[model samples]
Target: MKIQNKKTCIAVLILVTIEQVIKIVINNNFLDKKFPILPGFLYFEPMFNRDYSWFNSMFQLGVSKWIHIVFGAIMIILVYLFYQYLNYQFGTIKIVNIMYAFIFSGAMCSLIDKIFWNGSLDYILVNGFFTFDLKDVYINIFSGLIILSVLLKNKVLNQIDDNIVKDFTKYILRKL
Candidate 1:
């Protein structure tokens, strides 16, 4: 791998490790305990979310664990493919690589949560909004980075074409 790719991989591993370590500490010591951070706005209340997502729990979907695993696996693969596509199109843009690292690390951590922990060990609670963890923060950072990239580098967005879909299809076929 190239130096940039190796760096990105290392970043992903470090982020995933940090997230997993935090979850481990919370699970062992702080599960279900509430520690007020902002009193009414934010707090640390560890929660194990068994459902696949907030949408599933909110709608009472009762999605199976196996399904969650499969879906998570597919998402990880798609994220990787998209990352590859971006790299192929842009030739090692540092910001895109960083975005991929954050997003990929978050997705991997989420998959680990579902597969091993049996759910996400969310410890940060935003009162009246949602409960989340480091993985969620990584994803949110990736989202913000992508938005900023688009706003600052509109030419990159305009330059993208349908080749991404075609290349993705070719890649899948080759793998299959």
Candidate 2:
């Protein structure tokens, strides 16, 4: 692996390790206990969910817990494949690599929870919205970062291409 790749791996490992540690603590200490935070907007409570964060309604679509485990495993593999693809195709972009690391690490964290524990360990509760764990937070934020990095990359590339076209046009006009 290149230096950037190594750094990305290390960063992901550190983040995953931290997330798991926090999850273990929450699981052991505060399972199903709610501690209010930010009045009503946020709260800390450890709970388990067998389904993916965004799949509450679809979870009842005849998907069993064993199937969820299988899905989690498949997701982990897909995340790894996507990261490898990005590395091979766009190795020059460090931010993209880092974002991929975040995404993979987050997915791995959830997979670990799904396989070893009862379900995905969720704690952070948002009033009138949803509940999530650190792993979920990691996945959500890093996924957003991945999208942002791609958009920024495209914008930068477009600007550079536009500048090149303008410069060529100026050169042609001067020659004429």
lDDT (Cα, tens digit) per residue for candidate 2, span 15-129: 8999889887877777767888987799886677766445743456646667767887787765665455444444546766666677778788877876777577778889878
The true-structure Cα RMSD of candidate 1 reads: 2.2
Q: Write down the lDDT of every candidate, Cα atoms only.
A: 0.85, 0.69
Assess the local accuracy of residue 125 in candidate 2 as a C-alpha lDDT between 0 and 100: 82
Superposed model 2: Cα runs more than 4 Å off: 1-4, 56-59, 153-176
Deviating ranges (above 4 Å) for candidate 1: 1-4, 174-176
After best superposition, candidate 2 residue 89: deviation in angstroms? Answer: 2.2
